[model samples]
Target: MALTLALAVNELGTNSVKYGALSNDVGTVEITWSLRPGAEGRGRELVWTWVERGGPPVSPPSRRGFGRFLIERVLAADFEGTVKLEYASAGLVCALVAPAPEDRAS
Candidate 1:
């Protein structure tokens, strides 16, 4: 799980450095995460958000790349979670939600 997250974040950072928000002087990337109790008193859920701002105009990718696959599919599968990628005019936003380890055990 740690490796998966590392690779995922690395890919995002790489993209930002090369083409996205972080590419420009004024652009920035913010990442936030939280752990909360699951619905109906289950274990816990992990929610993470990655937001980019002040970069070039955002648009959906014409093709899914390996980074996209890792972030959207592989991570989701690994955590039994859901991943959302949004291309706002201002920047790219990604949200990931997954069951915590204890929740999975339950």
Candidate 2:
């Protein structure tokens, strides 16, 4: 799980450095996460969010790159989660929701 998250975040950071917020001095990226509780709080879900701001306008990539594939498929599969990418005109917002590993085995 750690490796998967590392790779996923690396992909996002790489993209930011290339064309997202980090491409410019005025831009910034905010990454946040929380655990959503389930019944008895025994089945919590991890929610990860990546938000870019003060950057050039955003648009869906013309193609689904390996990074996208990693987050959308690999990461999701590893954590049993779902990933959503929003390309609003303002910036890019990525949200990943997945079950906590320990909880998932229950």
Top candidate (lDDT): 1
Q: Per-residue lDDT for 1-106 in model 1, tens only? A: 8888889899988988887899999999999999998888878999988999999998898999999999999988888889998999998898989888777853
Supply the TM-score for candidate 2: 0.90
Local distance difference test, each candidate: 0.90, 0.87
Instruction: State, as a TM-score between 0 and 1, how close model 1 is to the true structure.
Output: 0.92
RMSD of 2: 2.0
Clash pairs, candidate 1, are none
Q: Give TM-scores for every candidate, taking all chains together and pairing residue i with residue i.
A: 0.92, 0.90
lDDT of 2 by residue, 17-53 (tens): 8988989999999999998885566688888999999
What is the clash count for each candidate, in the order shown?
0, 0
Model 2: CA > 4 A from native: 39-42
